[model samples]
Target: MSLEQGIVFSVLGITLAMFVWNRLRFDVVAMLALLAVAVAGLVPTEELFAGFGHPAVITVAAVLVISQGLVNGGVVDNIARLLGRIGHRPTLQVLTLTSVVALCSGFINNVGALALLMPVAIWMSREAGRSPSLLLMPLAFGSLLGGTMTLIGTPPNIIIASYRESGTFGLFDFAPVGVAITLAGIAFITLAGWRLTPRREENSADSKLFSVGEYVTELRIPADSPHAGSTLHSLLTTSGDEPDVVVLALIRGEQRLAAPSTYKVLREGDVLLVEADTTSLQTFLDTTGLELAHQAIDDQEAESEGASNNDGLADESRGRNGFRETNGHNDAVGAGDDKAASDPIAKGELHLVEAVIAPESSLVGQTANRLQLRENHQINIVAVARLGHRLKRRLGDIRFNAGDILLVQGFEDSLGGALAELGCLPLAERGLRLGSPRNTALASGIFLASIAVIVTGLLSAPVALVAAAVAMVLVKLLSAAEAYKAIDWSVIVLLAAMIPVGQAMESTGGAGLIAAQMLVLGENLSVASVLVMILVGTTLLSNVVNNAAAAIVVAPIALSLAGELQIASDAVLMAVAVGASCAFMTPIGHQSNALVMEPGGYQFGDYWRLGLPLTVIVTVVAVPVIMLVWT
Candidate 1:
């Protein structure tokens, strides 16, 4: 082999290893490979960054923005509401849910499609008295199947289409093979595949998906309370049959003491920030005679107002407990008419919501205090659950991770928007806007028009989709900030960096070498066997690395193999596309899988119970379909 080929192969090998290691971000690894190829003189410096402006990258970003607009315009919310009416039969529910998700996957970003619909799936499972495990995996897999049906449905398809020399593949070029495989795969899961999923029992009360054992709230000592002068340790000792609650902090007038000493004396009107389950919280309140801080504030306000009306005292007088009162409000506990107007808890508008952190959430590495969640969003992180394990760290100190289940407390009116801005997916049914008919009609019209323009050959996929995204912003379907935030920059970077590296593999004959070796392995086999080999290889690669990277690396090899065997390259490239989108075996294989892991109470081994058989079904169905459609 030439030295350039050797260097390219070495770099490619390391890149694959890094991707599998998964310690570094995939984009960082792709960038490292790009620099290695450029340093080896395999690619010119001028072309090193050209992949950034590639049509495939642009299309992926545009699709993500448009997907966000569709979500903002209430298209998916309306569909979810309709889905709630599907009957309680598990098979029928799985069939209908998977079918709808797959259909949506064809038009929008598959991960986005899965995220939006996941809560619906969870709600369905709950309503039917079944574990979410039965529906979540199938929903995620259905998204993968749906992405195969259209050229713009998946990043891998876009990358594969760009490999063609006769301009990129048309919008519907993939439909014949993709639709057949999708139909077959969805049918299998709906009939028998869902049964293979493990039914993990969630530890819940009142049919809630997440455990409410660690909810944190504040309790205030009344002036006449029996335990007002007790020590902190003594108070805990006497409050319950056992110490089922923990005092996290002591809130004195203007000072907050975290983990206060056991001997610290509790005084009248002192607030104790404690964590306990619902049952235990009630028991503690019943035993200690302490009132909820907010309730005490209200009671005090009524008494102070009564005194002012009867004696004509000033409204700003101090209460007996040394709390400054103004207009029947307490300054000590930070409650007033102004605060009550905005603070949901003060107005009895509080709701405890359970949500899973999205993979692309801005909250992934932030703590509650660092994000100022209570200050900015008026939400409190009451408890957190991770991978079926309850977290014991203090709320403000626990760093958020993707897939972490958070029990957040906030006002019902504005909580949905806050969670959306924080990139969280609520597990419970939320009040999603059904959208004014005009907004929905406008957004849907723009999306369909872009597709129509692409079908009629008026514009390329990237240009048409980008124009649609811009139009969505113009119509206020999505704000400028929302449009920018919708694009997953990590994916964009990975695609742009890996594109040149893929070209380097082909330019240096590395892909040809690999193709030659594969042909030798299948020396006496028919062309169909070679096609299966390519598909299977790409599927395995995608299960380890990003699907787009898998397609970029394997497309050239499939084309080279087709050339050697004297067959149409279209069939082989189609195999690569189908294979790259079938990453159902592991959570690391796809973002859709990871997104459902914690919420579904899935273990790493739980995926292949359904994923392995589904993969076999996809391969058995995809090969012949591709051959018949393209050959």
Candidate 2:
């Protein structure tokens, strides 16, 4: 081997090792590999960044934006709601949800389709009183199966299409092989796959799946509250009709009245700490006209803060400090005790989110009032649940403890930033988003037009999707800020950085060396064995590395193997496509799988119990279809 080939192979080895080790972030690892290759003289320094402009990267980014727009526009959410109405049995629900996710993935990005449907699955699980594990794995696996049905369904197919020397593979070329695999996969999952899922204990450290009723929270009595001037017994009687809604304490002027006497009179400006489910909270709020105590105070503080910034801060500083908070609290103001008297609950996008405090959380040991979370971040911790035990205390007085599940309510737009600031990991329960039929229809139309144009050859895939994303933004289907936030920047960076490194393998003859070695090892084996060998290698590699990176490395080897074996290259390439897209055995294999992991309350080992069988089904079915259709 040449010096360049040797160096490239060594870099590739270390890179693959790091990916499998799962230590560093994959994007960071990919960037390091790119830098290593350039420094090794395998790739020119000038061309290192060229991959950022590559069609594959552009198409992936555009697809992500369009997917997020569809989500924001409520296209997928509407479908999920309709599906929920139709399916009665758990098996039926799994079948319907998984099938729809797969079908959607055939035309759109698989990750996007999975992201949109995951909430629906979680909602169904919550309703059925089943662990999300029963549904999420199937939904994630289904998206992978569905992506195989079209050239644009996955990055590998697009990369494969771009590699074709003759006419590019038609949009529908993948349908025959992909449809067979998808059908077989969907059948196995619905009938047998989900049965293998282990049921996790609801209160286990590994599991956070529980009903909304389990959350303990505090709501304040506004001056207009009907319960004011009534006895504590009267307030509890009016609001605690539902057994799930329990009034635990009353807070008046830094004093906690726990289990107060029934004859105790409730007064204006008093805080009522209660434990209730989501339905009961809404009911109690509507019935008594009590606003979230912290939110009321925070809004007033934000207004004052906004006013001060407007008057004196420089433009850059204003932007920098706009949403900045220190230590999960506002350093500038107290709990805004005086401010709450004036600020009523202004109507806007308020979302109820359940977040688990991470071990390294900054909010630990600090009470909500001490942190001034409401004033600094506009977030109100309405409830706290520790180890399934409810904490009934004044929201301001209860200090946050690590692993405590907090149910916070805040504006829809600020929730992401606030979660980061507080070192909280959001529990996956697909909260409601504001999406209308008009926006949904517009997003659907833009998506269809992009696909139509691509199929008609009016424009290339990347250009068409880019145009669709831009149109979605222009039509206000998604705001400019929303569109930007929708794109997963880490994924984009990984793809851009890895593309040239993949090229280095081909340029330095490393890919050929590997392929030649593979051919020589399999010379005595039958062609069927050779095909399976290629498929198996690609599939295994995909589980450890990025699927696109796996495809880029294996595509050349598959084509080379076909040439040496005197077989149809199309069949071999089809094997590679199937192998690349079917990364079901590990969370790191595909983004769809990882997305469902936490929400489903899954451990790493949980994937293969269901995923292994599904993968076997894909292989057992894909091989014959590839040979029959292509050979």
Candidate 3:
């Protein structure tokens, strides 16, 4: 090989190694590779950032925004609710959910489709008393498999389409090979993949939906409390009695009573250490005229005039339980504006999120009080669940430890940044939108119209999808801020940075050199064998790096190899497209796999149990489909 080809190959090797190691972000590795190629004078420095503006990158970003629009406009909600009504039989549920997820993924961005369905999968697993592993791995694999069906379904398809010179592969070009492969893969996963999943203990902590009564809290008795003189036994029998509410201990005059007397009378200065879910705690306080000690003074001050005359929410039979002006004891936060007017989260700015602390979390040893989380991060720790035990401490005083799951509330825009700073990973996402029927119709209409425009050749795919995204913002289906957040910047960076490096490989004849080597190795093999080898190699590369990067790197070589074989390049390129989209063997292979890992309670090795067979099936099915359709 010449000097330029040797340098390009060396950079490609390093890049692929880093991707597999996964110590650095793929975007970071891509940029380093781009810089190395540019510094070597293989690509011009001025054109290094051209990939950011590439049509494929734009289309990927637009597709993501549009997917978010569908989510925020309640399109996914309607679908999920419809599918949720299906019975909870594990095999049937897996088939239905995975089929739906895969079908949606074929039209929308696969990761976006996975995000929309993950909560439903978790709920299904929880309701069925099954490990999330049974559902999540299949669902993730389904989304990946499904993405092969359409050009806009995944980034690899978009990248490969952009690389085609004849513009022969339009939006639906991938449908022939992709559909057959998706069907076979989905069938395998639905019928057998779930059974191969590891079965583990069913822990409520693993559920993304935080159940009520999982948090421990300390509530203080006030001077005017009617329960001040009531015995603990009588309180339990009272009309406001909640079975889940248990007094773990009592604190009075600096003494903690771990086993307080059942007949013990409550006092104004006494603090009751309680173990109750969030909902029960709210009801307990409202009915008994008790208040949180830390917020007692604030509660009094915030209590409006005639609030005492009103007898608080305890006496009133309001439909909503947790909408108190102060303390907010048991109010459940909804993902959309469906909440009652009294609900604080009904305001568009507020959101409730569950986040788990990572092992190396910065907040590991700090208490909320010390961090002044409310003041500094504008986040409130509503409750905490640690090791299946509810912590019976004041919300502010509970010290954070690794693996503690915290339910925190803050302004919607700041949650992502704040969670990152706290070294926490968000659990299952909740409350995607207001769920208005009108918004759903409008969003779906806009999306379909954009696709129609592309199919009709009125606009390019990137422009059409971009217009659709802009239309979503214009119609308020997604706010400008939300649209920006919907686009994954890291993915954008990786695609943009790697595009130039891919071009450098092609310009330097590195791809041709590699293709020549492969051709010589496969000289004695049949075309079918060569196709299988190409599919397997591309699938392995995609499993390690960003699939879009995989496509960009392999597409040229696939085309070159096909030329050397004196056969039609379409089938080989189709192989590259299909192979690049099926990264099911590892969690790091695709974002959808990574998205389901924590919630699924999955280990690194768990994926291949189902994924390996699924990959083999795709290869066995896709090669013939591509050869038949393209040749």
Best by lDDT: 1
* Winning candidate number (TM-score): 1
Q: What tens-digit string does per-residue lDDT give for candidate 2 at 427-505?
A: 5533545478888888899999998998999998888889999999999887888777666677788888888888898
TM-score of each model, in listed order: 0.83, 0.72, 0.74
Better of 2 and 3 by lDDT: 3
lDDT of 2: 0.73
Model 3 poorest ten-residue lDDT run: 314-323
Give the alpha carbon lDDT tens digit for every residue of 126-198 in model 3. Answer: 7777777788889988899889888899988888887776774788999999899988987888778789887
Regions more than 4 Å wrong, model 2:
201-351, 355-377, 380-406, 411-434
Q: How far is candidate 3 from the true structure (C-alpha RMSD, Å)?
A: 10.9
Task: Tell me the tens digit of each residue's lDDT in model 1 across 536-604.
Answer: 999999999989999999999888888888878888899999999999999989999989999889998
Question: Which prediction has more favorable lDDT, 1 or 3?
Answer: 1
**Alpha-carbon lDDT of model 1:** 0.82
lDDT for position 600 in model 1: 89
List the candidate 3 regions with Cα displacement exceeding 4 Å. 203-215, 219-373, 376-378, 381-434
The candidate 1 region of ten consecutive residues with least summed lDDT is 311-320
